[model samples]
Target: MQEVGSAGTIAVARRPEHRGRSLYTQALFRLLTQKPMGVLGLAIVVVLVVAAIGAPWMAPADPNALASGAKLEGPSLSHPFGTDNLGRDVFSRVVFGARISMTIGLVAVITSTVISVAIGVLSGFFGGVVDLLFQRLIDALIAFPGLVLILAMVAIFADTDLPGLPEEGAISTPTVVLMGTIGFLLGVGGSRIIRSAVLSVRASTYVEAAQSLGAGDLRLMRTHILPNVLPPTITLATLGLGTAILLEATLSFLGLGVPPNIATWGGMLNREARSWMTEAPWLALFPGLALSLAVFGFNMLGDALRDVLDPRLRT
Candidate 1:
C-alpha cells in the first residue's frame, strides 16, 4: 500500500511535466509543417524582435546625431536611408525605432492579457450579479470611440509623471500611460471573447472531474481554465501587436508619444515628412514601409497562429 501511494504521487507530479512536453512538441511539429505564409510571418517577426533587441549594435551611427550639412541628403553610400530634416541618420533612427515600436506592442499585449484574463475568469466562473454588472460595464467602455478616448487620455495625462518616466526603470513614460489607457480598453473589449472560451472550458468533463476531486476554484482557474483560454488570447495578442504599433505611431505622428527629440518612426514622418516629402521622399517612405512591414508581419503571424490553434483550419 505504501509503495502504491508513492507511485501515485510520482505520477501526479509528472502529469504537468508530461502535459508541458506534449504541448511543446505539438507546437514545434505544427511550426515545422506550417504554410509559406506562416513561415514568412515567423521570419519577419523574428527579424523585428532581433532588430528591436540589438538596435544599439545594429545602428550604423548615433540615431540622434546631427551631421553638418547632412540635412535632406538623398540616399547614398554613406547613408543608405538618407538624412532627415535634422540631418540625423534615418537608417540608424529607423533601426532604433524598432525597439520603441516592438516594446509598445509587447507592453500593450501583456497589459491586455492580464486584465482581460482576470475579467474573463471572474465573469465566466461566477455567473451571477457579478457577471451582469461586469458585462454591462465592459460594453459601455467598448462603446466609446477609441481614437477620441486615446487622445483624451493623452491630453489629461500630459502634465502628469506618467509621461515623464525616467530613462531606466520599470516604467517607460508617455508610453506607459498610453499603453495602460489602451490596454484597459482593449482588455475590456477582449474579455467577452475570453469569457466565451472560459464558458466552453468550464463545461468540459475534465473541469467537472477536477471540481469533484476537490480542486479549489483558484486552482481550477489557474491550472485548467487559464491554460485553455491562453491560445485564443495569444492569437488576439498577436493581432493586437500590429494594432498597438499602428496606434502608437499615430499618437507619435500627432506629437503625443515619447519626445520630439527621440527617434521614433512616426515622429520622423511628423517632423521630416511634413516639410520635406518632395525634397526627400525617402524620409517618409522608409519609415512608412517599416511600419507597414511590422503590421503585416504580426497580422500574418496571427493568421498562422489561428491555423495552428484550430485543427479545422490546418489545411
Candidate 2:
C-alpha cells in the first residue's frame, strides 16, 4: 500500500514535467530526426534572415549606387547576377531586397500574432459580453473584401515622403507603419482560430479541475489555457508569415508598398515590369524569383512546423 502511494505521488510530480514539454518540441525533434526537407527549409530561412539583416556589411557592391558603365550588363564572373537598367548590381540589390522582404514578413507576422492572440484570448476565456462584442467586430472586419481592403489602406496612407521628413532612402516610418497595420488586420484570423481552440479546451477535464480548485480567471487562462493553445498558435504564426509576405509583395506590385527608392522584391518587380520580358528578362526574373523563393521558404517551413507541432499528427 505504501509503495503504491509513493508511485502515485511520483506520477503526480511527473505530470507537470510532461506537460512542460510542449508538442512543438517533440514535433521539432521528429522533423530533425526524420524529415530532411523541413530542416533544409528552416536552414534557408535562417540564411535569408541573416543575409537580409547584414545587407550593408555582406553585400559586395552598393545596392543603390549607379554604375553608368555597367548598366544592362549580363551575368558574368565579375557581376554574378548581372546589372539592372540603372547599373545597380542585381546581385547586391537582391541581397539587400531580402532585408526589405523579410522585415515586412517578420514584423507583420509578429504584429498579427500579438493582436490576434490578445483579442482571441480575451474573447475565448471571458466569453459573455466580451466575446459577443469582439466576435461582432471581427465579423465586421471580415465583411470587407480582402484585396480591396488592403488596397484602400495603401491608397489612403501612401505618400512620397516619410512623415517627419527624413532624407531619401532612409527607413520609411510611414510605410512600415502601414504595412504593420495591414499585417495586424490580416492576422486577426489567428486569434479566432485560437479562440475556437480555447473554447474547446475550456471544457476539458484539467481546465474544469483548475476552475474547481478556485483558480482565478487570469490564472486559469494563462496557466491552464494559454499553454495548451500555444502549439497550434505557433503553427498559425509560422504559416501567417507566408501570407504576410505575399500580401506585402502584392501591395508593392500595385505600387502601394515602400517608397520609390527602396528596393524590395516587389518594388523591383514594379520598377522593372514594363518591358523586362522582351528587353531584359533578368531584371524582372531575379526579383520575382526572390519573392517566390521567400514565399516558398516560409510555406515549406510552416508545413513542416505544422506537422511537427500538431498533436493529431504525432504517432
Candidate 3:
C-alpha cells in the first residue's frame, strides 16, 4: 500500500505476513507453557471428564451391585480400590461418582454465570434506583451464611413432590433443586464482581463516546460493556466451578444432596464409610483423594485463567 507524505512523496506500507492470534488462543498457549500448575490442572480436569464419560465402559463392575462374599475386601486386581461395606466395588463407584460431581458442578456454574451476568450488567449499567434495589437484594442474600441458606432452601424443597416430573432420570428433581440453590447463592454474591467491572467500563471514555454518538443504552451495553466485562466473568465462573463441586460434596456428605441409593463421592464418605473408615481406610481415602484432586485442579486452572485473561495482569 502507498500513502502520500506531507512533502508529497509516496511511502510504502507492508501488511503483516499473518494475522495475530486470538486472545483465547494466546491465553491457552500461555496456560500450556508458562503455567505448569495450570497444565496439570487442565490434565486433571480432562481425566475427570474422560472418567465421567466412560464410566459405563470403564467401570469393572456395576457400581451398585453387591457381592456379599467379597464384602469389605481389600484392594486387589479384581477391585483396585477394594469393596465397600455393601460389597460394592469402590473403584466402580468412584468412576460413576465423577459423572455426578462433574455434571452438578458444570450445571451450577452455568446457572450462576447467567444469573450473575444478568443482574450485574443491569444493576451496574443502569445505576441509581435500579442499582440501589439490586444491591439491597444482593445484600440481603449475602447477609446470611451461604451454606446455612442453601441447607434451608434444600431442606424446605427436598420432599416437595412435583407433578409430571420423573423421580429418576439423567437428573432428579432433588439434584436439580440442589444445583439451583447453589447457583442462586453464588450468582447473587458473584454479581458484585461483575457490577464493579461494569462500573469501570461505564466510566470509560469509549462509553461516553458511544453515548455521544447517539447510541442507545442497550447498544452501548452490548457493544462495549458486555465485551469488557466478559473476561472477569469468565474468570469468576471458572473459579466457581471448584466451589460448586465442593459445595455439592458437602451437601451430599451431610445427607442433604442426592439420594443415598445413587453413588457419589460424598455419599461414599457418609455414615457407612465413616464407620468403616478405621476398619477399611480405602473407603474414605479414595473418594476423598478424588474430591481433593478435582477441587484443586479447577482452582488452579481458574487462577491461571484469571492471570492470563485479566489485562491488568497480562505481561
Question: Best TM-score goes to which candidate?
Answer: 3
Estimate TM-scores for all models. Answer: 0.89, 0.88, 0.91
Model 2: lDDT equals 0.75
Instruction: Residues 1-315, candidate 2: write the lDDT tens digits.
Output: 012264453111111324566545677789888767778778878888888889999777998889899888888877887888888888888899888777787788888888877888899988999999999988888886777877776666555455675534525755675566667676776778889878977777666765665769998777777887777677787778778878877877777756778777877788865556567778888888888877777777878887777667755
User: How accurate locally is residue 135 in candidate 1, as Cα lDDT from 0 to 100?
Assistant: 95
Instruction: Write down the worst ten-residue block by lDDT for model 3.
Output: 11-20
Put down candidate 3 lDDT per residue, 164-268, tens digits, no spaces.
Answer: 666764377788888998899889989999999999988886677557657799888877888878878888888898899899889889988688788898988
Lowest summed-lDDT stretch of 10 residues in model 1? 9-18
Write model 1 residue lDDT over 1-315, tens digit each, in one string.
Answer: 012274464112211323555765676578658667767877889999999999999888999898888988889989999998778889999999989888888888889888888999899987899899999998788888888898898888766674356643324566688888777777778899889988988887677766766789999898888877777788888888988888889988998856677777888889888888888899999999999999998998888887777555766
Each prediction's Cα lDDT score? 0.81, 0.75, 0.86
Q: Arrange candidates, best TM-score first.
A: 3, 1, 2
Over the full model, what C-alpha lDDT does candidate 3 score relative to the true structure? 0.86
User: What TM-score would you give candidate 2 relative to the actual structure?
Assistant: 0.88
User: Which 10 successive residues of model 2 have the least lDDT summed?
Assistant: 9-18
Deviation (Å) of 141 in candidate 1 = 0.9
- After superposing candidate 3, which stretches have Cα over 4 Å from the reference? 1-21, 168-170
Rank all candidate structures by their lDDT, best first, as comma-separated numbers.
Answer: 3, 1, 2
